[model samples]
Target chain A: MKKHNYSAGPCILPQEVFEKSAQAILDFNNSGLSILEISHRSKDFVAVMDEARALVLELLNLEGKGYEVLFLGGGASLEFLMVPYNLMKVNGKAAYLDTGTWASGAIKEAKHFGETVVVASSKPENYNHIPKGYTIPSDADYFHCTSNNTIFGTQMKSFPETNIPLVCDMSSDIFSRVLDFSKFDLIYAGAQKNMGPAGATLVVVKTEILGKTGRTIPSMLDYQQHVSKESMYNTPPVFPVYASLLTLQWLKKLGGIAAIEKINDAKANLLYSEIDRNPLFKGTVAKEDRSNMNVTFLLNDEAHQEKFDSMWKAAGISGLAGHRSVGGYRASMYNALPLESVQVLVDVMQELEKNS
Target chain B: MKKHNYSAGPCILPQEVFEKSAQAILDFNNSGLSILEISHRSKDFVAVMDEARALVLELLNLEGKGYEVLFLGGGASLEFLMVPYNLMKVNGKAAYLDTGTWASGAIKEAKHFGETVVVASSKPENYNHIPKGYTIPSDADYFHCTSNNTIFGTQMKSFPETNIPLVCDMSSDIFSRVLDFSKFDLIYAGAQKNMGPAGATLVVVKTEILGKTGRTIPSMLDYQQHVSKESMYNTPPVFPVYASLLTLQWLKKLGGIAAIEKINDAKANLLYSEIDRNPLFKGTVAKEDRSNMNVTFLLNDEAHQEKFDSMWKAAGISGLAGHRSVGGYRASMYNALPLESVQVLVDVMQELEKNS
Candidate 1:
């Protein structure tokens, strides 16, 4: 059976990326040493690091724009702590918009460093939509938000325009679509979802925005030190960075973010349309806020749930079960997810409606 | 020519371990999903994590000994800061032995959280020998030491018997020897030298020693919280952990640390004998303090440098160049390095002597 992977993350990646990464692990750049065993400072692995950093800037179209890129270990969960450790001042406040689980995690970490005010939240609605029309406080040292919520299947369509530094966690939606990269002072993403694998976190920060936080930041969490060291402050997570480089290369070869966004939209539209047109199923999030990356839905009747799940399983679908909190289905269509997989889900939904 | 990897780390691993890890990356446990794409919570990976943790305790003979093992990202450098953040209480003091570069790094980070007293240091002699005849302060909250110095090629032959909590960084010599596991409250090793790769840090902490610091630690850096969460406090460096599991399995099959320690001793002896007897080369560190893992030596004459360098390169030897600070050759004989490779290095030295 042809497998259709919808695992949230570490999720789908281009097949070519997998093949290349596998080969590198066996014999990195023909060095006769597995990528698993070579030094990160070795010429071959250094080239992997250099190319990965360059391609990130190239894909974002932020080259030569005073934005520095870093690949660090410890995922976005660590970034939740690091962002405020290096940015939020000792006595100042940072404003956050709580949209989902990840945003709430970020807020919790930030409060440990300084005062944090939640400007707005969609938690009352179970985070079914991105919060909007919230006022940004000028006195806040920075305005932080999560650009996409993987669990709730909602994405922020527009970012808040503010004079305060803007820090966004683009973990689930990075490289899936085009975005105005210049508007934010800092952006970070864990590479598990849209990028490559689970290990390295991609951090992009404007140099000018750093060094203003008066607290003494640990070297590992200090943004300025990492930027100065070119992300070689310490031995990095080498394999994941190499895999990310391959994925970035795939994205660039496929004409970058602009080309992928069109396909992503088509995939989301096809799945959502099937849910709405078929009487058996209903889309979960609001129409305007539906995520192009993760399409979430549910059956109209409880009796059809087991039948629909088995049908998808028999059709070779995996990881479609929704988060425990949401309790339905979530088909994550990352950058490498083909339109055919989305069609397979749509076909399953149609067959279920007719048969039931 | 068969290649001999002598890079400090990410260094080398057993051939079977590499093959198994490579296959896992391509198709993990016949799941049709690349290890790179599988969720950390998946049964396959959870098994890998569980087995890896179990093997660590088993090898150390610490099973059911109240010690908790964790695999985390950010390498040993991050642990430098994390150790102090979680263990050093406000206004308390920690005693550290400054053996070499990494120990100094740990001392630097520890001072930021609490008072750090360097009870003894070998810096006066360019860190070529481990300092002795110094006393660890009984009033200190803890006594910290680095077991092996990769750059300086020094190893502590004995540990301080102190009532204070003992913490040791065993990055270079972990799993290569047998030690009294009960003597230390915490033992942390970066997985690069004698283990697997460069991302994950192996932490074994006695559960009772935690939660005494009375400082607010960021969740990512808090040892007690990580223990409660079972090291999935966040998405771990999944690939590295998987590879480490395979390596640990390889170690166990080869009879664990006691068995590897014998091979490691043989390899170090073979290499050191050549360096001492050849007359063309000389060992660097003091005899008693010489590391069984890393053997540092220097050419007697600068004039034979090119001839000896090309001779080893032609023999398929790699990473024999010493650290810049030491300005000599370092043959790191980790457990994965076979005796035949050490014989090859010795043969090359003999050939160079004959040619010179």
Candidate 2:
């Protein structure tokens, strides 16, 4: 049976890209060398790094604004501490939007480095919706936001225009839509979602935003350290970076960001419409601010959850269970997910509705 | 053309292993999900973590010992700082043998934490030979050594048999030889060389030696944290771990470490014997301390250097240049390099000699 993946992360990848990537790992473009064995400094590996970084800049349509593309170790959890450590000015506070678990996790790490002001939070409502009408502090070092909340299934459709520099943790929805790179000084994401594997963290930071922090930070935690060394500050995670590079190539070949975003939006729409029509499934997130990446929903009767799960598994739909914190279903519709898969999921929901 | 990969670290991997690893990155075990998309808590990833760790322990032949095997982020450079921070106590000294750049790096990072004693150094001879007659300190926290100096190409043939907790940075020559691992309390290696990719670091440490140092270390930096978290402390380098696991399975299927060591010796013998018999070549490291993993040699006629380099590159051989610190030739015969590749290298050396 052909399996359709709905995993929240470590998510789906295009088959064409996957095949080429697999070949490289095996024989590495007829070099008869595994990509895993090459040194980061070698001309071959250097080309991989150079092309990957170049492709990232090309993908975002940002061609030379002094922004660096780095594939670094440690996930977004590390970035939580890093962003503030590098960009937050001396004695200055950074404002953050607390939309979900990851957003709050970022806030927690940022506070340890400098003063973090929560400009907006959905915590009182259990993070199901994005909080609005929150003041953006002009004195703040940067306003941070989680663009797509993976767990809560909410997204910032339009970013807030803050006087201060904008820093967004676009971990879950990067490259899933047409990004406005000029509005934000920096954007970073864990590659597990909408990218490649989990080892590498994709960091895109405007050079002007750096060197503001006066605090003496460790080398690994410093963003400028990575940019200067070209993300080979130490030996990089080569295989993951290669995988991501392949993904960027795949995305580019599929007609850049605009074309993919159309496909992604269509996929998300189908799933969302299904959840709305089916009484057994009630969408968990607010209608206005629902995520186009992760669609979180719950059954009208919780006891039917087991049957629903088993049926989906039997139908070869995997990783549909929502986060336990918001128990039900979450069908992640990233760039790589085919619309047909979403349709399959919708058909299953309809069958359950008819039976009920 | 079958490319002969002589590049040091990240140089080559088995084609089959790379293929398998790349497939997993797309949809692990054909489960129709990117391995990166899956939760670390999932049974699949947990099995990966366990099998990789188990193989390392099994390869080292320490199945029932007090040692704990951990796959952590940050390369051996981080481990250089970590080893002292975890093992060196306030006012407690550790003995170190400085052979080359990596050993010197370890020594410098150690000084930042606690007392350090330099037992012996080969730097006076420009790292062409391993230092000997080092008096191992008894009351010291531990005696540290780099098992094989990657650049200088010198290895410690006989480990110090002292009862004290003997620690070694085996980042270069780990698994290249069969050894009694019980002799050392801690052994670590970066996966770029003999292991798999560049992101993951393998640490085999004795459980009894920890907690003696009273210094407060960060959770991620502490070895105990990885042990307790089962190396998933901070969303580990999933792609790298999977690649490493594939390599491990390949190693086990090839009759484990013992069988590979025999082949390793044969490859080393083939290269060194040519260097010894040929009038055009000369081995740099002392005969007794010659590294079986990385063979460093130089031509007697320095004039052949440029031609030699050109010939190797033209013949599709890569990364044969010696370290900048040592101007010669280094053929790093890591585990992934087939015996045929070594034979090809020897044939090239012979051809170069004949033409000259």
Candidate 3:
């Protein structure tokens, strides 16, 4: 049976990524060495690192724009700390738009550095919608926001214009849509969703924004140190970086984010339409702020829960269970998740409605 | 041709680990989903994380010793910063043994927290030997050292007895030999050399020694947070952790460290003896302080370097070049490296001597 994996990050990557990465583990480029056993500094792996960094810039259309791409270890959770350490200065203020869990986490870390001002938050409404019309402090060191909230199924439809440096945690939505990426001074995403596997985080930063903070930053957390070393600041998570390159290559071959955005839109529309149209189901997030990558919906009648789950399981849908915080089903349709898989999920949802 | 990989960390792993991990990537446990695509919270991966953590304790004989094993990302370099963040108090001091580059790196990070005392150092001699007879400060929050120096090919034969929390970075030597693992309160190793791959790090720390630091640690760098959450504090580097588990399983199947240590000793002895006896080459470090994992040697005559390099390449020996700082030849015979591979290199050395 073909499994439609909608696993939330560490989520579905392309099938070709699976095949090629598996083959690389067996024999990397016919070098007779497992990719797992090769040195990060070797010519072969260096080529991989270089190509991956270059490809990330090329795909984002940020090449020749003072952007440096780094495939670093530790997830976006670490970035929450690094962002503050690298950008936030002693006695300086940072403005943050708290959209969901991750954004709040970043805000929490930023507070440790200095004064962190939450411009606005949708936490009162249980983060069902992206906070809008948030004021940005002109004197703040930087403005930070989460582009998409996987747990709440909310995404920022439009970013706030600000004079301060823009930093966004696009962990769940990066490479899944087309955006004027150059607007953000710094962007980071864990390579689990719409990228690669779980071990590495993708950081794209404009070089001009770093090193202005007066405080001394630790080497691992310093963006300037990582950029200077070309992301090999320490032995990077080699496998994750390689797998991400494979995924980015797969994405490029499928016509970059512009093409994938259309497909993603179609997938999100199909499932959301079924939820909205069907009498037994309804969407959890606000309509306007709904995430195209992760679709959250609830059964109108709680009595049909068991039956709906069984139907989806029978249809080979995996990772449909919503996060514990949110009680409902979450279909994470990342870049690698095909439109047909979303159709399968929609059909299951429709079948449940008919049975109910 | 069979390649004998002697690349220092991210070097060689067991053949079975390669095959099994590759298979898992394609179809994990016959679940019809690549391990790369599965959720870290899924039962299958959870079981892997649990087993890997347990095996680390069991192999090190640290189970029931109040030691918690955490498989984290960001490598040992990240752990360098994390150690101080979690262990060093705001006004407290730390005692360190400056063995080599990594040790100095750790000391540099520790200085940012509070007073860091380098009790002794072998760096003046190019890190050719581990500093001995160092008196750890009784008032220090913790005593730190590197168990093995990969770059300089040196290993600590004995640890200083200290009442203070003992921390060691065993990035290149963990799991290769049997030791009184409880002697150290915290042990961290980047999983690339004797362990698994380059993405994950193994941190074994005694639970009782934590939370004493007065400084508020960031959530990502907090040991208590990771332990409380069972090392899934955030989505861990799944693939590296999983591969590390497979390598650990292979080690256990081969009768754990005691069994592998004998083989490791044999491989080291065979190669080191040749470096000492052969007229064409000489060992780098002091005889008593030589590392079993990495054997560094230099040619007696630099003019024969070209001929010797070609000979080894032809013999299918790869990654034998020493680190740039210690430019010569280094045969990194980790646990997974068969004794026969060492023999092949020794044979090449004999050939070089005859030709000379």
Candidate 4:
């Protein structure tokens, strides 16, 4: 069987992204220096920065808006604190939706800066679904949510339509589908998922919402400082930025988000359908709130777990085992995951069913 | 002519490091997925981290000591703040030897946490030397210094024996010499310099000297947090760490720090001797302070600047240009800079002198 990667992150990349990236590493822009050596301030690299930032706005189709695209050093975990630090005024309370591990991590970081109101939480059920029916406070600095819960395989399919700024930790599923970006003030993603490697976090923020926080933030942690310096305040993770750029180019070539969204939906549908139709498999997240990015499931009988694992490993499908924090199986279907890989996985489920 | 790279960083790597890294990126340990795709938490990658950490101690001959090696996300700039956060607890005073832009940046970052005393500063003379004779405050928690100044091309040939903890930013000149590391309580280097790439920081800290700071620090910004977790409180930068591991293996194969230090000494001596002997060029820093890592010089005649630049460019030497803030020529002679490249540059200088 062909090798497939389902490793939640530092996960997967389109084969083309890898090919083009490897070529550039040896010799970037045909310059004598490898892409590895070129200065971020050099014209070739500056053009890369421009194109990357432009593509981010373009991909979201927010070309006319005042959103500043920032590629920063620390990953989304940094943004977990940064979002509140940048948006929360002195003693300001922010409303947070506690969906899973990452969302709670973000809430923990936010509490360091100001009061955090956990408007809704799914902890009682171990975060099987995005919490609903909790009123969002307009007076709170912003309403924070995790667009997709990577660990628990839950997604906030419908965001609350409120005037309050909707801030999201969209680390795992940012570029996987078309986002109604106008509905949110800030959206940040760690590049490891759907974008590139782990060094850079891509932040899309409205310029108007910044500079209101009263905290004296460190330059590295401050979003406004990055904006004023145009993300050139310091040496960036150059290769990852270039890889993200290449992946975006791949996305653009593959007909942008709308086209890719259909393909992703089809891939997720195939696997979810297989789980629904099969007697031995059952998804962990509630059916309505299941994530297309991370499709998690469990065996009907625990005795078959080892058998399924061995068969899948032998067939060359990797990263299919679920996070130990939430065990069973999780096949992360990020944008780079090919439909064929899912087909292989689906075929394995069918094979197991037939054997049984 | 062979190409030479003197970039401050994402700088030169030995041809061997590049060859090995390029191959690994294309087909990592025959794992089918790129090394970039593997999670840092994976067994394969955990081995990469283990070997890299072990190699650091092995090459430095710093094993079984007070030092603890850490590969972290933020560059040495992050360590600027982190150092004081962990160790600066005595009377709110942290003394700094302001050697250059980077060392001064550290002092600035430290001020946020405690009272920072610039015990000595070389700035008025454009950071041409490490200042001397300013007393280290016995009551100060730690005295910080940059081992080798990257911009102005000066080095502290002998570290100050301090009653207080000695913190050094060894970014540009690490792996270029055999050091009595026992003198340093903390040494940090951004890996873009001598190690591998720009995203990771190699921090060597005395483990016993932490957690005394009464102030609360953001978990991400605290050194104790990283030490306790072994640099995996969250996902670390996997690719850079692995690439650094490969580079360290290459360093070990080149016969570790002792063997490489001999070559480094020869390379620095040859270039500095030519600078002293040549009629067309004049060395900038005082003889006692000139850095072995970066050789800074100016043309004897200001009009010879363009000719000198054209000559180097024609010979394919890149990033030989000094930082704009400090103009003239700065040939950064990191360990990866082959002696032949330096010879070519020396020959070019001689040829220019002959023409003059």
- lDDT by residue for model 2 over A1-356, one digit each (tens)? 55787888877778776777777766776776767776788777799899999998998988888788888876777687778878887788989999999888888777766788998889888898988888998988899999999988999999888778899999899988886887888899988888887778899988988887787655666788889999887788887888888889998888988999899889988888888877787888789999999999989998787777777887889888889898888888888889999888888888777876
Model 1, stretches more than 4 Å misplaced?
A: none
Model 1 chain B worst lDDT run, 10 consecutive residues: B17-26
Model 3 CA deviation exceeding 4 Å by range: none
Report the C-alpha lDDT of model 3 over B1-356, residue by residue, as the tens digit. 54899989798999999999999999999998988988999999999999999999999999999999999999899988899888988888899999899999999988888899999999899999987877888999999999989999999988888889999999999999999999999999999998899999999999999999888888999999999999999999999999999999999999999999999999988998898899889988988899999899999899999999999999999999999999999989999999999999999999989988
Winning candidate number (DockQ): 3
Output the lDDT of residue A6, model 3.
86
Ranking by lDDT: 3, 1, 4, 2
Error of 3 at B287 (Å): 0.6
For candidate 1, lDDT tens digit of each residue in A185-215? 8999999998888989999998898999888
lDDT for each residue of candidate 4 in A220-252, tens digit (9 for 90 to 100): 667887898888777777878888999999999
DockQ of candidate 2 (2 decimals): 0.52
Which candidate comes out best when scored by lDDT? 3
Give Cα distance to truth, residue B303, candidate 4, Å: 1.1
- Residue A91 Cα positional deviation in candidate 4, in Å, after optimal superposition: 2.1
lDDT of 3 at A287: 97
Tell me how each candidate scores on DockQ against the true complex: 0.73, 0.52, 0.86, 0.56
Q: Ten-residue segment with the worst summed lDDT in candidate 2 chain B?
A: B25-34
- Model 3 chain B worst lDDT run, 10 consecutive residues: B1-10
Interface CA RMSD of each prediction in angstroms: 1.3, 2.5, 0.9, 1.9
